[model samples]
Every structure is written in C-alpha cells, then in structure tokens.
Target: MNRRRFFGFLQKEFRHIFRDRRTMLILFGMPIVQILLFGFAITNEIKNVNVAVLDMAHDDVSRDITNRILSSEYFHLYQNLHSEKEIEAAFKSGKVKEVIVFENNLAKNIYSKNIGNIQLIGDATDPNTANTIVAYTRAILLNYQQELNKGSKPPAIIQTEVRMWFNEELKGVYLFVPGVMTIIMMLVSAMMTSISLAREKETGTLEALMVSPLKSWQVILGKVIPYLVLSFSITLLTLGLSMFVFHVPIRGNIFLLLGEVLLFVITALSFGILISSIAPNQMAAMLISMMGLMLPTIILSGYIFPIDNMPVPLQVISNIIPARWFISMLRDIMLKGAGWSVVWKDTCVLAFMAVVFLFLASRRFKMKLR
Candidate 1:
C-alpha cells in the first residue's frame, strides 16, 4: 500500500510538470535554442569579409594577387577604387573591412627590380578580427612571393605595408566598452521594467490602475519614466568609467552620443513593456527577458562575436535585435568619431522599433483593461 501511494504521487508530479507549458518550454525549448545559438554564434573564425582594392598597377601581378585573396573563403571583393582618396570614405561607410593597394608597376618591379610594394589597410574597430584578417592576407601574399621566387637566384621580396585604421594600437577596450554599455543599458531598462510591470500584474495593482481614471498610455508612461531615467544615468556612468578608467575615447559629439543613448533606452523600455504585457507573472517576465533579450543581446548583437562571421540565419535574426544597432552606433561615435551622418540609419531603425513595441504594448494593455 505504501509503495503504491509513492508511485501515485510520482505520477501526479509528472503529470503536473507535463501540463505546464511554461515549464516544458523552460525545460525543452530554452536548452535547444541556447545550444543552437551558442554552437553557431560563438566562433572566432571569420568568413566572407568584405575588402576593397585600389590597384594603381592594374598589371597581371596585381590582378593575380587580387584574385588570390578573393578566391579564398575568407574574403569577398566589395569594391574597386581608382584613387587613394577613396580609402577613407570606404572605411567610413562601414561596408569595407580591408583595402588592398598595389603600387604602379607591380609586375614590372617584381621582375626587373626583384621587389614589389603592396599596402594592406584594415579596419581595426574590432581588433581581433582585424588582426586575423591582416594575418591571412600576409600569408596569401607570402605564398605568392614564394611561388615567384622558386626559379630565381635572389628571391623577389613583396614589401607589404600594413595599416590598421581607427584603432591603430588595436585596443580591446575600444571594442568591449560599447558592447558592455549596451548590455548594461538593456538589462537595467528592459529586464527591470518588464519584471516591475509583471510584478504589478501579479500583485493585482495593474488591474486596479486599469479600473481607475488613469489612461492606458499614462499608466504605461508612469511605469516607464523612472526606469528610463535610471537607464540613462547608468549609461552616463558607464561612459565615464570607460573614458576615465579604461581610457576609451569618445571622439564624436558628446551631445549626439547622449541623444543616441536616450533613443536606445526608450527602445529598450518599450521592449520591456511589450514583454511584460505578454508575460503571465514576474518570473515569466524575468525568464523572457533573460532568454529573449539578454542572451540575444550578448550573442547576436555583434558584441562579443562578429556578426559577419555568424551563419546567414543568425545574421538575419540579429537585425531585429535592438542592441545590434545601438552597439554599432556606440562604436562609430566613440571609437571612430562618427557623426550623425554615419549613425542616422541605425538611429532611425531603433526609433521605428520603439514605436512598434509601444504600439503593441498599448494594445495589449487595453485588452487587459477590457
């Protein structure tokens, strides 16, 4: 009789666990999603890096080297430039990672003088990737040089001049500061806001507000304002620490940086409201914020991992993550001294996301009132 009672209790517990959809999702869905994201997203290997070429030589040797670099799986040809002046613009556009410039008489100089000159310029905003790219490029050039010198008495030397733009010293702090700021802002604004709202719902205060004279928008704004101010303060604090302690430079307009930070905070707050509207309780809201916002921000936001190196599906999914745009803006403004012209598109995207999230949240809040 005792054994039968214990088996019955075990069966009842199993049934309860299986019946709870949230628990099942937590058990089954999160692990699979986390594994897939971690497996594909966390990698140092770079692929399909966009490169521009400025071939002053336009000779067979220059063309051969260009073909060699592009043929490798590591790089893709993004543009061909006619002059030296276009290099800065290319890097500023953020589309080109590396630029190859061959001197005027590459093939002739190689054969006659036993020397050829090639300049490799890399964008060092992400120093690790930039270093890896430079290393790969040098290896290719070295292989070509070896091939040419096989029959020669004096092995022809290809003098490669390497330049790392933006972050000349290749500081890791320059890359991480922006990403860390983004994550911290997201946590304080989105996760905290969502959990706060969810707590109100769980405690029945949200329903009381719905029944009161307060408008839906007013109630939502009231919940969001405090968090917004807090998030902005946190942003400023992080910026100060990065500049003073880490020695990260903010070369762009400080006002513009603040404006962008405010915009991103609002966006994150709106996202929090949306999550809270959908969550049934504070625990669910917290879990949703962690699994949905935090993990994606850390993994898919180009914070630690290069988005270009991620798989195509993840790269596409990353576009929807708000941190991706904000982090990019932060890096451009702080590290690259980029102005509004460089970051405007990202700002617009964040604004649009905030509006959409707010609209959805309002609709959901209204439904709860009804």
Candidate 2:
C-alpha cells in the first residue's frame, strides 16, 4: 500500500464526514438521545402504576391490604369500587392498569383456616407490565402473610426467593445499556458506512476512484477507516454515559471490552460494505441497513426478548444475527464479570463472521467495478 495515497484518501473521507452536519448529528446526537431515552424513559420496572380496589369486605384486613399496596412504590390506589362491574370501565378508560378484588369474608376465611380469595385483575395488553404488577402484588400479600404468622408456625410453604444475579435491583438501565450500545454501533459502523460508500457510487466518485492508482482494497479501507474511528468514539461516549450517568458497571477487564468492541465494529462494517456493494444508491443502502440490520439487531439479537422464548425457527434465525453474539458477550463481561474463557466462543463467532462478510463484500465490490 502507498502510504501517501492511503493517508490522502483517509483525509478526504474524514473531511466528507465533518463537512456534513447531518452526519455529525447522527454520529454524536443519536447515541446520547437513545441511551438516555432507554435508560430512563423505557423501563420494565413498575413504578407509580394506577390500580382500582374492589373491597366487598370493608374489614380491617382488607383495608390494611389496600393500604399496604398503595403505600408501596409499585401501585397507586386510583379509586375504590363496591362491585366488580366497575373493573371493565376502569380498564376500558385506561385509567387503571390493575384491579384488586377482596372476597366478602376475607378476614373470617383467613382466621378460620379457610382459603381467603383475592383476585388480581390486570390489563393484559402489556403482558410484561401485567406480570410484573401481579408479581409485586403477590409479594406484598406474602409480606402481609408473614406479618400475620410472625409467631405461629405456618404449614409447609414452598417459598421460592428469586435472586437476580449480576443485577440485583433489576434496573432497566442494566438491561438496556448493552442493547443500546449494539444498536448504536451497528447504525454508526454498518449503516453509516454503507450509505457513505453508496453516496460515492451515486455521485460518480466511485468510478474515478476505481480508475485511480489506489487498489480496490485501499479504496474500501479508506471509506471504512473514517467510520471505524467515529464508531469507536461513539462506543467510548456510550460506555462513559452508561457508567457515569446510568451507573452500569463494567466489571470485566477494560482491554477485553475494547477488544470485543473492535471485533464487533469490524464485523458490522463488513456487513455495511456487503450492503453497499449490492445497493445501487444511498437510499437503498440506508433502507437495507435500517430494515435488514436494525430490525434483526433489535428483535432477534435477544436484546429486548429472550431467544429461547421464541419459536424454534426464530431461535435458529437469531444465531445468524451478529448482534446476538456481541450483546451476549457484553452482558457476560459487564454484568457477570466473565473472562475470556467464558466469552471466547462468542469472539470466535464474530471474527469468523467478519471474515466471511468481508470476503463476500470484497468479491461483490470488485464485481461491481467490472
């Protein structure tokens, strides 16, 4: 490779990036906005959720249970209902997310060693929140039961205490940080690189470059180097914000994290190059990157949803998504404080994908020139 020519090409690519305000905004602004949005605004942890109470028994036990649920951070007692008829209206109006119905002889049944029924009705439109609300309500009731059985020996209760490892508090930020980082990296490295290269083809600059002294590999490298730097910077910015602002800890070796970051960057950029080689224009490249890369990264990467929970076909499809492996590595390293031993398989998978993608991209890109 000619050093002067390569350096000149790199400089030109950097200039192109800096000259565009929109590109700069996307490179910088989007990461921060998305991170903050998911960190704070989008969360699974229930807080200040509204609920209506149907108290058929206005006894002390029923009143105490209602008071306990309201006092907790998870639920807010929106209103009291005398009958179950108001539940449908409460849910339909979108005023309350849940309704707690206490049976008529709640206190008597509990005192007389009979099963005291309490029905928890939740709006299942949001299954996740509904499950969480039910869980919290059950926890509160369990606490109340423990209080009642303070001195007495209760019957054999199979108490299952779920301890969430790595993330004890169950903060949504813990779940979102790694996924958000994957998305930002994919967009910056893969999507942006594809668009930038496609713009060259659209503007007829690629033809000039093709006929120039610069080899095909050098030209591809020139286009990639700028996005690589930008993507790395974004990675650092995202990690810093997550650590400082959101307090998501990085427990593994810093070098390991950086190594994985570099691997995934190259992997994503290879995918971008492959897309750019096939797409005739920047618009097509952008759409392919957004729809093809972004959607799979979000859906199939086990970011928001667990892959195991998906159907067999979708679970198999998820294996091909590079983000799935990268995000898995991130979680293992960051949350579990795992070492290379735990994550080496993932690293190998990414490296192999990067090689395969780059090979395909190089061939397709060369074919395009002919």
The TM-score values for the models, in the order shown, are 0.57, 0.84
Candidate 1, run of 10 with poorest lDDT: 30-39
Angstrom error of the Cα, residue 288, model 1: value is 0.9
Residue pairs in clash, model 1: none
For 1-370, candidate 1 gives per-residue lDDT tens digits of: 6445444434543454347667445433433343333333533347899999999998999999999999999999999999999999999999998999999999999999999999999888866677768878999999999998998998899999988543243445567767877887888778877887888789987787666655667667766776676667666766776577556789999999999998999889888989998898999999999999999999999998889889999999999999999999998999889999999999999999989987887778762543
Q: How many pairs of residues collide in each model?
A: 0, 0
Q: Note the residue pairs that clash in candidate 2.
A: none
Q: Tell me the tens digit of each residue's lDDT in model 2 across 176-224.
A: 7889889989998999899999999999988887777888898889989
Per-model lDDT = 0.81, 0.86
Cα error, candidate 1, residue 343 (Å) = 1.1
TM-score of 2: 0.84
How big is the positional error of residue 225 in model 1, measured in Å on the Cα after superposition?
A: 0.9
